[model samples]
Target: MICNVFTQSIKRKYLVLAFVLVCGLTIMVSYYKPISHRYMFLPDTQVANLNFYDQNVISGFVFGKGTPMAVSCPLLLSGNKQEMLVAQSFKRTTRIPSFYYSYLAKNCSLFKSRRNYITSSLTLEEEQFPIAYSMVVYKDVEQVERLLRSIYRPQNIYCVHLDNKSEPEFRETLTEITNCFQNVFVSKESLDVRWGTMSVLEADLICMHELWKYKSWKYFINLTGQEFPLKTNAEIVGILKNLNGKNNIRKSVLNRWATRWEKAGKAPAGIIPVKGDLQIAVNREFVDYVLHNKTAKKFLKWCSKTKVPDETFFVSLHYNKHLKIGGSYTDDQGNSTDPPYITRFKTWEGTAKPCHGKYVRRVCVYGVGDLPLLINRKELFVNKLHLDFEPLALDCLEETLYNVTRNEYFQTLEGNGPPKHT
Candidate 1:
């Protein structure tokens, strides 16, 4: 009887140990899963195994069209009014903190596994001709990370300039994330970027200086944290190749305040100050000229004393034929009308189609309703997505891009053809 009692006690102990092990696993799973996944409507099992390259998984859940279509579609894309309301009610409950990135950095393989960062050049053209990006970011670390991930290509180089006034945690998280990539780095010199100020131009200059070290890059594109790409890397390379050597700098009619530069005597003599967008896609030669040319240096220095120097500096250099900056537009284009450029697509308040998303500071913060238009835009990138206001907008855009990229990559591998560049 004593022997039988001992045997029963052993079985009881084994059951208790098994229960503890199961509880431990549940806790670990909850703790390790990213907060972003919690907002996804997919079942935990499907989301846990989600893979962009898996055709079976992507065709169903990723594209939002499969069995149980209502649940499969991203909440924002659902036609049901109730689902739309549910998405509207969903808010980012927590900021992705520094520790999260720190953990990822420690486990680099796990970091790469969690997100679909294209680690290889998908095409020969992309590998042969790499692009450089300058990102000036201040707030919204999560948005910054997502933007980086969406545009990330191993062949490309990235220089991120963080605002000096940003939170320490923001800096820490960015540093950790950038540390994972060889080509990506945070600018050593941080500036306090303010709107309508020379600091904006200065931030880009700092990145340009650093990016100049990467001799292999063919073109330089400046971006902000809120923007996301509309084209894949291969598509972007094809477009840049078509440009041959010309720059894509938007030139607009001079602002009424242009006289202020002349009044202050800050304008270089005989050099006309013009207004244009801060975002630009200039060739390596243009970037080199801006970094080292004596005339460009003088123009930039003079611009410092003027209001909103960013709106004038690059455009002025490109328009002034006398400067002879490589890849610049020699003709006086922006004296009367805004010249067209395909570098970025932004919806300003009171212009073009009505903003489906709400306006903040006169810029449209894109919502899910804007996805159709965004997908159709030919611009390389689209500007200003607010994670808090409409996270699904970004989520859907990102998923679509991922699927497109995967399909293009596989098609090329099958000897079909290169990605079609519009």
Candidate 2:
């Protein structure tokens, strides 16, 4: 009997050990599994259902295997011409009404789950050095939601300013989306933001004031709803870290619009008026100075009365040396030839390299053909992708970004070096 009892105890110990090893192996496999496989088991939802395109094709395009011959190349190059044609046909025929977003935002948990937002910080550096975004949006709730998801990071903060002219349903749906995330909120003030108008600058300022309350953010990037990020959050953080507190705003010689400001006597004295694109990447100190400094406040007031104030206000302040603004560079620092602005990439209507996508207001609305150039461009973000024009372009780009983000996260786990983007 004594021998039998000892044998039984030994058997129990062996069984326990076997169970432990199996559990350890299972966990390791689960942890090391690809994100695509993990998501495959998730329930079908708008965000959860990511198998909208062939993984092989997306991977090939993103990794630069099957680049199109030209900007106007047919969708046949993407490896799914029929599907692209069908999607394009559907988008052209159907209109996604505003209520669609209202329904999607109804259940916050399911909404987030389906959207598959990266709820945790991917890296220590990204978490510690948070970035602030001010998104000014008016139409296309679907595109707006996709853009938010593509750039969403829990560590960062976002303040969305809707055009006052936007429909009431649009505002409600946007608020619903923002409410789902603790870090994102809709701006209390809304403006009827007309193109090239002071309202555009005012809308940005409203968010700037709101975003300033969050003291932890390192940089501020303003984006429109139509824009999408070319780089992942980690990549953007890496680039911004390299800036060493210098602002990224393109400075051009004063345009014909400057004469209007001068003739109206609204241009600030002792301040040379300069013009630039409205999209900017500025540091927190610059934002604070723009909000609190006396000269900046006066310039803002003067800009309010001037035409296309949004294009001139920030660049003028950044180019002026006397302001001593953090990250400010003066005209003497290579202002004659405008250095490339890496913040945003946009193709105008009549460039030597014509827009492959249709032009809306002389700006390219990126189509499926433009993916080759877009994927290879070194800019942080690409401007103007419309869902109605070519849903496949946005779809393929979103999938590409998803793959890049997943690869980046796994690369971090393997102790690989950081992502390098020129």
Candidate 3:
């Protein structure tokens, strides 16, 4: 009787194991429901849906160039709904480079958990204002990734915009790069990063608008990816703290603050320049005023009718409306002492209003590349510097970080934080 009982028990165990194995296989297949499995990563023929995420994969966002960014915005969402491989499955099947986060982790402390920043003396808490970077990636994306790795701390976030005209392969690569950021974001309009004139300011507004909407960051700075720092982060905090101690930043902002005058029944054509766009330092109050002001919002609404009305639009408003409040100072150049505000770099030589008149495209070199030449616009917070200036800016060191341009970085206290992890 004991032998018979043992034999029966062993048979039951085998049956139970077989049932469990079958159920496990069913669940695995459900999670990985095969959708046109292609053993390719990031297809060039068309950007396909990534199949493996617990989340739904949508159209790929691109980065384009110029002030208004004619091409970038259209690329925001894709209409391509072709049958494709899952991003996870494709990645597993394809032989691409193994992934890692050396840039966002070691370089910028963008993610929430890693918010420590190091500078000469700026303590993290003392640095009252927030900073934002406006970056556009074109070719040399690998170099761009390296630039992101070297600069921008977590305290400051990067708003990256790509041009739409870039190759599909490059676009897919960029998508992978920015996915690592909690703080870093891809812009809505993917303009041509290299060609468009409006791309510069367009990127600025995008960053400012989104940062204002999402994060509590008080200041908005427009920094390019290629140009590294000229000053230590700590010195920046000190400068901003000192500025706040003296000025009323709320009444000031960087925009063309021109109000519409009732002249001969024409539309509101009046305009003036703001102070922050002067390539200097900024405080929280100023950023809030321009980005959140009811009057400014109305002004923007009015200006929308003007044909590509970006140039001098913000400037006219900022300088004219706020001038009475003792907020902004102007510089005509060829005059000795630096204006109350300072700009870090020289602008591309051309009349800003080319669309209304005859304007020629210009080549820019910030470092070794033939990038579009641009001044570190004090206005628009930070504008694209000619890439030729990157190494120079890197060498200058202190100037890039803390000096007061017209309307840029803020001041604060010294920092005691962890050294970067290489």
Best by TM-score: 1
TM-score of every candidate relative to the true structure: 0.81, 0.78, 0.47
> What stretches of model 1 exceed 4 Å from their correct place?
1-96, 259-262, 333-339
Better of 2 and 3 by lDDT: 2
lDDT of 2 by residue, 292-411 (tens): 998898998888777788888998898887878878785585554333578999997877754667999999998776777788787899998988787667766776787777788888
Q: Give the deviation of candidate 2 from the true structure as CA RMSD.
A: 12.5
lDDT of the structure predicted as candidate 1: 0.78
Q: What's model 3's lDDT at 358? A: 15
Worst lDDT 10-window in candidate 2 = 67-76
**Clashes per candidate (backbone, < 3 Å):** 0, 1, 98
Each model's Cα RMSD: 6.1, 12.5, 15.4
Candidates arranged by lDDT, highest first: 1, 2, 3
Model 2 misplaced regions, further than 4 Å: 1-100, 253-257, 331-339
User: What's model 1's TM-score?
Assistant: 0.81
lDDT for each residue of candidate 1 in 97-158, tens digit (9 for 90 to 100): 45555556655677765544678887887899999999999888778987898788899999
lDDT of 1 at 191: 93
Provide the lowest-lDDT 10-residue window in model 3. Answer: 54-63
